[model samples]
Target: MSGVTLSNVVKKYGETQVIHGVELTVDPGEFCVFVGPSGCGKSTLLRMIAGLEETSAGEIRIGTRDVTRLDPAQRGVAMVFQTYALYPHMSVAENMGFGLKMNGHPKAEIREKVAKASSILHLDDYLHRKPKALSGGQRQRVAIGRAIVRGPEVFLFDEPLSNLDAELRVEMRVEIARLHREIGATMIYVTHDQVEAMTLADKIVVLRGGRVEQVGAPLDLYREPDNLFVAGFIGSPAMNLLPAHPTEGGIHVPALGPEVIACRPPGHVSELVAGFRPQSLRIGAGDTHSVEMTEALGGVSFIHCARDGQPKLVIETKGNHVERPGTDISVHVDPDEMFLFDKLTGHRLR
Candidate 1:
């Protein structure tokens, strides 16, 4: 397994620059994910590493070789796209070994590789089935098996689960995670879904507006985000950011209550934004806000609360407790659990 490295990588289409100077390194046998909103340069950067996109500037190295100007085939990387892209006419085994066949490999070698890949992906039973005869998940597994047969140094997945239903997506996620563990191959996955990023990545690169906002392990990014964007984007349902003002001894949050939260702010900061995860908040004893909605998902519930002129807040509660719409309630959050950001620059106060 070979590590992938990007040094000040840049991409541009004539005068339009989409990917700015990006610096990243995926350790050998590491599962790295590039995650962000739509129009962010995650996919573009992945394509650059795969040699699918031209690198306008900077160096890209696979292991020690500079592959910046190399073709996709020469980069020792295999990409699985969002679509299965299977040939309707070919059997699963045929599809998996087609690349080797096209490249002049002997039939015996193709069969051996295909067999091994099929076993690894649990596609042994469906090897003779055509794409039309298989389920969406099985088709995707075939696509993955095709890449596995190549034995590339790196595996690149471009939202390969986007086409699957929710149940199939979860099932495929487990399969992909298992595949990574078994093969120990360097994998760079691109997805706009934070849930996938959180569950699949050993390291995640959060990108936005053609630049990287932050990069770290999943829990590290979740527990301590670098900025407002990351703090809001990393968590499910997102962090609740409310307008706040620094007072003499603490910060005053208008949405929560009139009581000032005892948290120190930077000396020069005037306007501040306070962040709290839904799980960190609770329904307290006063009528500070009205319940707007409740999403009860069996064992857990998310109560959406709102107040006039204040940003809506979602509070996560356990059990089957449901808050009625228009029900008056107060939200409480510990000051220690609160995240502070400068409203002007959107930078963390830490």
Candidate 2:
């Protein structure tokens, strides 16, 4: 296993910079996920570390070797792309052992390595099958087995499960976690899916506009997002935001009329946009919502309500509840769960 370090890294295409001065460290045997929306440079960053893309200026080190300008094969990193990228004509075993054979490893050693990897990924039964003959998950496992037989120090996955259906996605996710545990190699996974990041990462690096936004454990980022972007980006139903004016050391919603324009000031007080997750706000006698619609998803339901004529609120609730259109309903919000963002900069107050 090996650690990866990027110091003051910058990636540019002509005059346009796709990656800013980025600095990050992936610990040996740690599972670090690079998660962000599309065009956020996550895969690009991974490619830079793999030496597939040359950094405009910076240094990349794998273990103790400074490999900023090294070719991909010499970087001790293996990347599994979204596409299976398997050799169509070759059998699973040949594909898995292709790297070893090309590198001139002994025939017996290649067989032993491929066998061990196939056993680990449960591909032993499909060794003779070609890519077209295997299921999606099985094909992906063969792809992973190819990476495994190389015995690389770092494993990089670029949205590896995007092609699979939901059920297979979950299965592959668990398989990756198990593989990480069994092999104990440094892994950097990139995906736009928050659920994947939340479930699979030991540490999550959230990115935006080609810059690092926040890095922390999954639950920590969920609970204490660094800014409005993160607060809205990290949750399932997303945080509810409302325009309000500061009043009497608290916040006021003039649109809700005089009586119900109530909520104490949040801890991170600033000339801010007040925010709270829809899940954290509750409908109560004193709290309020202007019911617009409802969306039910099995045991859980998404109650879409609004205040005045503003955008609807997406609230997740346990069980179905009947509601009429445009009916006024009260909702309670816990002050501690509220997040405050500077109106102009969108930066968090604390």
Query: What alpha-carbon RMSD in Å does predicted model 2 have with respect to the real structure?
Result: 2.2
The TM-score values for the models, in the order shown, are 0.99, 0.93
**What is the per-residue lDDT of model 2 for residues 213-291, given as tens digits with 9 covering 90 to 100?**
9999999998888888888889787777665556775676443335433456555554667777877766776545787
**Per-model CA lDDT versus the true structure:** 0.94, 0.86
Candidate 1 error regions (>4 Å): none
Which stretch of 10 consecutive residues in model 1 shows the poorest summed lDDT? 257-266
Q: Write the per-residue lDDT of candidate 1 for residues 1-350, one digit (tens) a residue.
A: 99999999999999999999999989999999999999999999999999888999999999999999999999899999999999999999999999999999999999999999999999999999999999999999999999999999999999999999999999999999999999999999999999999999999999998899999999999999989999999988899999998997899989888888886667899999999999999888989999999999989999999888888998999999899999999888888899999999999988
Best by TM-score: 1
Candidate 1: lDDT of 269? 91
Q: Model 2, residue 236: displacement in angstroms?
A: 0.9
